[model samples]
Target: MSLIQLYDTTLRDGTQAEDISFLVADKIRVAEKLDELGIHYIEGGWPGSNPKDISFFREIKKVRLTQAKVAAFGSTRRAKTTPDKDNNIRTLIQAEPDTVTIFGKTWDFHVREALRISLEENLELINDSLAYLKNHVGEVVYDAEHFFDGYKANPDYALQTLKAAEAAGVDCIVLCDTNGGTLPHEIPAIMEKVRATVATPLGIHAHNDSECAVANSLMAVACGAVHVQGTINGFGERCGNANLCSIIPALKLKFGHECISDEQLKTLRILSRTIYEMANLIPNKHQPYVGNSAFAHKGGVHVSAIQRHPETYEHIRPELVGNVTRVLVSDLSGRSNILAKAEQFNINLDSKDPLTQEILENIKDLENRGFQFEGAEASFELLMRRALGTLRHYFSVIGFRVIDSKRHEEEKPSSEATVQVKVGGRIEHTAAEGNGPVNALDHALRKALESFYPQLRDVRLFDYKVRVLPAGKGTASMTRVLIESGDKTSRWGTVGVSDNIIDASYQALVDALLYKLVKDQEQAG
Candidate 1:
């Protein structure tokens, strides 16, 4: 088989997903990332549809890509219109991309209903648009929209659409599962028939509404399609397009195909994360290969086995995808779990040491009381260091007081906190006001400490999460507070649990400060 081509449409179809919007600058940055990932073709948005896409096409020329060819995406000429006269075709040519892709109605149902044109006219539109675009661009791709459903609805007409594209001298004919409802089982027969009908090289463009986009894409390749079109992290309309994050690795590692170099493959996780950050979407942690939890081990047995031989639990080495193995601490943790964490933290401990068992029991007991450590590994590390008597005494909080009051119904509630602490026998006391009780407490605590540990000035709270544990206790329920703090270098999570929300927050806050102090001390050493 020839080398498979990777075509990314994140800037085009990915923006169609709900709650996703990318500026012209963002689209350019993403195109650069896709180029870095070694994708063969990038479909910039439809130049004819919107001004932003036109702006993107204008701006992207400033970037220098090494391998990828940027392609402008658009639809075929309108019914009763000539390719030269149609504005969509003219705009695509004006973009002057290295390649142009135009989707044409393939389903006879769509030709009759959506386009409201006769079957022959739709073919003419497909052939005329590609032939015209081909004269201007080095490569032209024809996307047969709803090709699978069209083939199933009317096999002969779907075959004719590919033939029309072939006659137009298209570089590739892409079969699109536009509705995303096609099952994987239905791909092999359809691809076999299509291959027999058209001499044009075939590509597969799948959607995930049936949760089979990735599977269907792989199946299409197995059935002899050489070009694959998808979006990063599967971002697209409806259930999203087939995820190149999954497809790329499967092709390279599983099928023994080289869609990208091994060095480029190592950057897959970073690419996935960068796109997520650009879209302002929280990454799906359970996403295969690139997600945070993809290689996370929490169960005691699983952790034990992976510690011996990672392949016992993981299908592939995490580092191959630029991810690391994470051991989560919970009630299910065993001695192996503690030891594994100790190794991860670079702390040496004998397997039979009593400290290991002691830490294991303490973690289990704390988890039983609703103190979660999985998301709060910083707090867990502090717990272990304190147990081993290696942690330094940064400062100790003596006591704290909080007051919240609202003067009138229309007035917002105001909170003030008073904090007292002792740093190496020097007593410091301070009070501060804030928008809420937790904010007031954090402000008061920092004010009381910054003068003693000046480096504390760099510390800031990044995220705060509060979960009510064991529901049905109403206001009396135990609350777990997880505080994420960061400075110039890095971020860490600390957790606290108590019936009092403020107290829980204070516990997390104190641990956060102590962890920062320890990190600073280690770096100085």
Candidate 2:
């Protein structure tokens, strides 16, 4: 296998995604992370397009990167302008990137319609822009925007466009599926023709519009392209760019390519999730290789088989990509699932023990009543410990009441909750007000217990999600609540279900606090 250069466009194309924006510091930090991951190139956005990108290029110079060359992205010089006079070209040089990548129109349609220039003029534009930048920049990469579509329309013109960039001395010629409509079957022939046409090193930059970006990139590589351009977690405009998260692992493990070290490949999942968090987007749990469910097992038979031998159900060892094999419990769970979970929780339980079957039945019954423990593992652990008679009763709630009142139509409703709890023999009652009934109950419960268990002060509710079962029932349907709680050290999830939303919230809130106390005891031991 040949060496493949990984060019990441997350800092540039990824920011074009809706609801995704990064600060200058965020870009620099991401570039550092990419460098650590052994990425070859990091495209630091188009400096000539926006002030924020210009600031990123200015600020990133202060940070030292051991690997990965920072590249500035922009378009080729305009049809009627000289490279020296074009503001875009001038700003790209000023960015002082280790490399420069500029896109030029390859499609006959775009050359005539978008640029309103003759085909020969567009060729001159491509040649002149790259030839001038090659003198100023250490390396220049040319992106043939709409190359595949242009090849399908007018093949000769497209190949000539590439030859123009090659004649201008570009380091690499990147064929872009800008529309992302090309399928995998169409890539090899075009790539082979391009390889025969130009001696320049070739690259592939694909988007995910047809859900074929990863496939197309791999196919292009199989056909002799040496460089791949994509974004982390596939974040980009519209359907997003090719996912480097999927491509890197596929190249390393399946193709046996030497792009990244095995140690660097182990950080793939962390990198994917970190980028999602920085972009303020939730991680795609179903995404291949790096998702939460990438190696999770939910079926009884599948879990049993994996327990005996992981190869039965898993393709690659989850640890290879910094993930773990997870067994989910539900109505489908069997003895193997219970045993697997017990082992995961560090609890001692025999497979033949009646308590194991009992716990499994209890979980099935609870799930039947609309309680889900998939995202609420803390609650499931507590349930298992309780069944084993190993759990401590930190506090007993005697009663709790929540009241909501609105005296005027224009005024917001007010919620207040009072709680009475017993810590051993002493009883404490406290009342608190909050923005909602659930928040009020949480506040009152914490107030009533913080004096006895000061550790409760360290725990806070991080997230709350409510889902109504049997959707058409609306207000009358059962409500399931999932609460995420965290302290300075760790975070865990708890769940509850009831007809009343407030009661469901209370159950989850109680579990959240009790789980925290249980964690404290476990750490102490």
Candidate 3:
């Protein structure tokens, strides 16, 4: 098996997604995580693009990465300007990453229309930029933007671009499918042509406009491209870039490539989920390999088959990617699904246990009432604990009042909440103000419990998501709120459902605090 290099552009290209944005601190943290995964190269960002990226490059230097080399991204020197005089090239050098990757116009249309420069002038830009950077940087990677399209339009000119970079002593030449329209079957021929034209090692950078970025990258590697460029969770402009979460496993398991060790591969799910958490984006549950639903079995037949032989329903072991096989309890779930979940939770229950049938009936009834346990495992666990008579009562809510008003035209709306709760034998009353009713409620609830459970101060709600349930009646719907909370050491999720949105949010918030308290007590004991 040939060793293929994994290059991550999450901090740079991945941020181009409409919903994705990363601070300098986030970039540094993500870089450390990617390094921990033993990725070959980490493209920090374009130093010339913004202050945040510039700060990222400076801050990332302080991080002692164990394996990955940080790469600084930029474009070629401007038309008619010397490489030494170009500000973009100068900024890349100032960023001082381990490698410098500069993209140049490869398509004849871009050279003539976008750059508005002659074909020979564009060639000079590629050659001069790479040669100038080669002297200062240990490695210079030339990204031929729109290479496949360029090859299709003018194959001879595109091949000349790769030859120009190679002659300029570039360390690697990356063929970019900037438009992401190239079919997988078309990649082999282009790779063959590029290999014949240039002696330098080839790389691939693919976008996902056609939903084939992963396929294109794999195809490129199969055809002799050694370096694979992509972003975590497929985050990027347009549809997205090639998803590294999918590609890494594909390379390791399917292709027999050694990108990362088996141990590091197990951290793949955590890495994928962590990125989504940091970005404040809900992870796509159905995403391949690392998604929540990747190994989930819902059908009765599938669950029964998987219980007897996992390979019958699963393509690969879920543990290989740090994900677990889930047997969801829904209207479609079977007794085997409940048994599997019970075993996972370590509950002493047999498939033939009377309580098992009761739990299954309860799950079906609750699901019919718009409760989804698949995404709300905390709630599901609490339900099982209650049924098993093992639930820990941390606190009880007596009452709560929330008020929202705008007293003056010039003033912003204000929200205030008062919460009364009982912990042990004492009743605590608290009042607090917040930007919104939910925030006020959250503050007041925590304040009420703070005196009895001071550790509640360490618990913070990071994410709150609300979904309105389907209504069986006309013009009325219930709401479900999922709250993700964390302390210094760990994080967990809890869920709530009610006709009132505030009530639903409050239920989730209370469960979040209670869950943390119970967990802390258990750990302490």
Candidate 4:
């Protein structure tokens, strides 16, 4: 089996994503993580692109990467410029990386349309770019920009472009799905053609426009490619690039490739999530390796079989991918699921107590009311703890009210909330205002709790989401709320349900804070 080298551009191509920007310090932080995760190469950023990128390269040296080479990314030289004189080449030199990758137009259409240059000039562009990077760095990689589409249009010209890169002595030639239009089946033949033409090591760079970037990249590797370039969580232009999360595990477990260490594999899930959260984006639910729903079983028959034998329904064990197997509690959850989940919560359903029936009935009722327990583990924890006599309350709200007015003829309504609560068996009075009454209530509650438990300082609301119950039909409009909070490495999620949005938010927030307090106590003990 050919050893596949993973090249990560999460800091480079990843930043091109809409509304995605990384601080120079943030890029360095992720770079350090990738290095520790044992990725072969980390593409910092395009030094010539902007000030932040330049600063990233300047600051990146301060970080130490164990098993990765920092590769600087940029395009090839201009239509008519020497390697030393080209501004792009100087940017690559200034980056001072051990490796530099420059992409040039391989498609005839892009040369004539985008660059307004002749075919011969475009060929020179590819050759000159690789030579320029080679002169400065020990390893130089050239990307056949739009190689797949170029091959489909003019196979001979595309092959010639790769040949030019090979003749220039590039360390690797990467085939790019620039427009991300290539399919998995089409990659095998294209790779075969490119392999037949070029002698240098080949790489695959893919994008997720067709939602097959990872599949296409794997196919390319199956054919002959040795280097795979991607971004964490598939962050890139358009639909994004091939996701490294799926690529790494696929190569390591299924393909006999040893790119990253087992320890790195453990960190892969957290790293993927960290990148997503920093990007201010939600992790894709269906993302193969580290997705929340990747290992979740929702079917009743599958759940039953899983209880009898875990391998009955799972392909890859969830733990191998730094994810946990989740028995999704929905209408699909059966008696087996109830037992398994109850056991996980340390609740003895066999106690033959009325509380067992009560708990199960409450689960059905709350789920019917739109409270999803899959992510609301805090709610489930509270339920089980309450049943087991292990749960403790940080504070209990006495009464809360929302004051609104319709005094103005054409003005948006204002919301102010007042809440009375008991903390540590003592009354604490506080009032806070927020954009919404719920926010005000949350602020007030936290302010009151802070007096008693100052360590709650690390706990802050990370996310707030609401969903209307699908099964609601009566006058009581059941709404479900999920609140996610975090403190350093610990994340707590809680759920609540009510017709009133403020009430739902308050409930979820309180549970979330209380759960954090409980977990902190557990860790301390």
Best by the lDDT measure: 2
Q: Lowest lDDT 10-mer window, candidate 4?
A: 468-477
Question: Candidate 3: RMSD over Cα atoms?
Answer: 3.0
Clashing pairs in 3: none
The CA lDDT of each predicted structure is: 0.94, 0.94, 0.90, 0.83
Predicted candidate 3 versus true structure: per-residue lDDT over 163-213, tens digit per residue: 889989998899999999999999987888778888899999999999999
**What is the per-residue lDDT of model 4 for residues 214-255, given as tens digits with 9 covering 90 to 100?**
999999889988999999999899999999999999998898
lDDT of 4 at 324: 83
Give the TM-score of each candidate: 0.97, 0.98, 0.89, 0.91
Off by over 4 Å in 4: 351-357, 388-396, 405-415, 422-430, 447-458, 470-476, 520-525
Q: Encode model 2's per-residue lDDT on 1-525: one tens digit a residue.
A: 778999999999999888999998899889999998999999999999999999998898998999899999999998778999999999999999999999999999999999999999999999999999999999999999999999999999999999999999999999999999999999988998999999999999999999999999999988888999999999999999999999999998999888999999999999988888888777898899899889988899999999989999988998888888999988988899999999999999998899999999999999999999888999999999999999998999999999999999999999999999999999999999999999999999999999998999999787899998995887899999999899998888899999999999999999999999899998999
Q: How high a TM-score does candidate 3 get?
A: 0.89
Which candidate has the top score in TM-score?
Answer: 2
- TM-score-better candidate, 2 vs 3: 2
State in Å the error of residue 110, model 4.
1.8
How far out, in Å, is residue 416 in model 4?
Answer: 3.7
